[model samples]
Target: MSWTDERIEQLRSMWEKGLTASQIADELGGVSRNAVIGKAHRLGLKSRPSPVKATDAKLAKPAKSPAAPKPAAAPPRAAVPAAPRPAAPPPKPEPRPAVAAPPTPDGAAPVPKPDAPRIVSIGPGGFIRQGPGDQQAPIPPAPPRRLVPAKPSPEIADKTSLLDLNDRICRWPMGHPGEPDFHFCGEAVNPGFPYCVEHCGRAYQAQLPRGTRRPPPPPPFGGPRVR
Candidate 1:
């Protein structure tokens, strides 16, 4: 693009001011970025003097000389009295009665219960491996053992609460869910003594008794044929 006279004048000043071609190109804009340098060379603009047109665009750069000392600044213009530093604004009045904050809360917000847990598949068979914090918790001291409730005995208090069946103590709270596969369908709870509503009902009939398994019946009491 052809350079405008004004642009050429600015270019001269920029060059005299020791600006690099890149700087001049930025100011001029639009022309091939290299146009500034080409035009200056074609027009015989001498940055220093002995320099011939640069052979390689890459090496066309000339080393910068120390900047010319700036002219002494003109004496500071007579001060016109800066509007009298606007009267130091009056200090903000102190609060009359500062609000007393409610006594700091006894403790900060309660710690949130951890999220249920995200199931992650890791093993080759896609077996789930829990993320960390697995053992951190000390198996919440299994809640106070609730007694397994017996069948809905007539004596049961609320038919709902197992303690009603028989004050029989349970290692675990009664009525709780039991192993999925073994839970019984017969009675919602075992009938005899106190039985775990969860475990007793479904226990193998022979093992129905609450405590340890009973000794085998004395070998089916042999026939007393000794008349």
Candidate 2:
């Protein structure tokens, strides 16, 4: 059976007893959690009220009673004999006649063979469930996407790289240590002769005179390396 009013009430009672949604769903074999939540919300189902103690119930009684009181002092009256009233007639009995069962429709009594693929609720649990044939709620379609390309920002492009951010495009110490003009014992800190702060060079060398070092060599690329 679907989650009818009675089933919702049962769920409310179970909730009052502290059973969780998953527990309820498990007991139901496979009722959807959303279904339970929706039913509870729509029906305003809530945990049962706490039981009131007998003493508390008595304490809540009104101080003033609504019943009228009888006179305290009363005068005596002469005794008189009275005749007894006649007995009331016996109550009329209800006529319960034999009733016959309605005739079954033709072919309905054959108990047509059960279909092979049909699913059945095997557990004896009290929870309600939806039919396997019931259509599931549809999944929503994906949202439309923007197709705009990312444009590079001129402000960022114009920002200069810090001195320490040398990406090492220079092959200044062209040949390795042992080659000619390798300058194994090299030292030109700013020009980063041997070890360009990366310590990639194994040897060090002293700097050349003012007009030395091949006029700071052209940037391998025809473009300028700095502004």
Candidate 3:
């Protein structure tokens, strides 16, 4: 609610009389305590500190106790001379031996041979070799491996290549179209036949009368089956 002139004067009077925000709000109808507080703050109105209640004053003042006796004065400390520190132990001697002086340049140092591949203790009789070029101990060269040509199987090796065939491919469609697992037969077509040997068996069942057309044998294991 808007703070009318009458409400503003009433709020100021109530605040000066030590009335809380809630009490002021109750006095002025249609106004909340927060609204009253906000208007009071905007009007630069100051609130008086709350006076101590009767019960609070009684609890705040603690009862007095009897005076305690004073403690006796302590005696003065005696001065004592500090004992002399023990002499530091002698320095420890080094454990390592002194290095020997190098010989004069007139006596040249022995040169070390270049490092190469060396064989050590291959078999019994202590056959240790210093290097491959060492003539005294010789190792024989390994024999070359002979490779045999692999024979092709009649079933797979005889089949026509998919690359050599025309775009016809196998006519046998696997599952119905619009199906989740729909797929078509992709094998090369047999000569004079729409379906491959595998699909041929699936496309046409065995004849009822004496069979004139003998269907080709089913494809090998793991080959596609007729859906």
TM-score of 2: 0.19
Q: After superposition, how far is residue 200 of candidate 2 from its true place, in Å?
A: 99
TM per candidate comes to: 0.21, 0.19, 0.25
lDDT of 1 by residue, 71-172 (tens): 988887776866656667879887655444444478655544444556665877877676675546655565687788455535433333422233443333
**Over 4 Å off in model 1, which ranges?**
48-227
For candidate 3, write residues 1-227 as lDDT tens digits: 78789889998899988888888889898989789888988999995554547568889899999889889889988989999999999999877554455676789874554444365546567776555466664578889989875554453354333333455677566565555444456687777788788887787786666566667787789688779
Clashes of each: 3, 5, 0
TM-score of 1: 0.21
Which of 1 and 2 is ahead in TM-score? 1
Q: Answer with 2 or 3, whichever has the higher TM-score.
A: 3
lDDT for predicted candidate 1 compared with the true structure: 0.61
How close to the true structure is residue 8 of candidate 2, measured as C-alpha lDDT? 69
Quantify all predictions' global Cα lDDT against the true fold: 0.61, 0.57, 0.72
lDDT (Cα, 0-100) at 146 in candidate 1: 78
